[model samples]
Target: MSRTKSERYFFLDDADREAVQAKGRAHNRLGLVVHLTSLRYPGRFIPDPRQVPTEIVAYLAE
Candidate 1:
């Protein structure tokens, strides 16, 4: 995933913060968002989020 797509799909806005926070763990939070967004864009879970682009992860982390 690119930074652009990550921002467009995986970017967790304030509205998503509460739900993501409820996940209660760093990996879970990221994984949830990644899984959700993946279903929207590339239309699949990408198998392993760790393989996600560094730029995408960095942008979503913001």
Candidate 2:
């Protein structure tokens, strides 16, 4: 039997979540999320939001 891929969970805790929310505006929020997720994952910081993955951008947008 083939093994399935693992699920990735991007859960931001209360204090951290508030800090992220405090960044101000959708533009700034997206930027900070990109910076944070880049370090959490195996990728580098994306310079453009248009270039960031749809999955990542959607998750952060929530």
Candidate 3:
């Protein structure tokens, strides 16, 4: 994991934290690791397989 920090709130995979490392590699950014306790609507949380962030998505495609 990259040693960067910030105050922005974002979500990531709980199981594969490698995504976090990947995110860091993409932008070299990081912050307080606040774990989400619950999801208000699980449906809204589902990721769209067709659309993904450009940087990390490229890695997934490979």
TM-score winner among the candidates? 1
Write down the lDDT of every candidate, Cα atoms only.
Answer: 0.74, 0.63, 0.31
Q: What is the lDDT of candidate 2?
A: 0.63
Q: Model 3, residue 45: what's the lDDT?
A: 38
Name the lDDT value of residue 19 in candidate 2.
87
Which is the leading candidate under lDDT?
Answer: 1
Instruction: Report clashes for each candidate as comma-separated counts.
Output: 0, 0, 0
Ranking by lDDT, best first?
A: 1, 2, 3
Each candidate structure's TM-score, on Cα atoms with residue i matched to residue i, is 0.69, 0.64, 0.20
Candidate 3 Cα outliers beyond 4 Å, as residue runs: 1-44, 47-51
- Give a tens-digit lDDT track for model 3, residues 1-62: 11121111233455435644545443332321121211221223334433333433333222
Candidate 2 residue runs with Cα over 4 Å from true position: 1-9, 47-49
Instruction: In angstroms, give how far residue 43 of model 2 lies from its true place.
Output: 5.5
Candidate 3 accuracy as lDDT: 0.31
TM-score-best of 1 and 3: 1
Clashing residue pairs for model 1: none
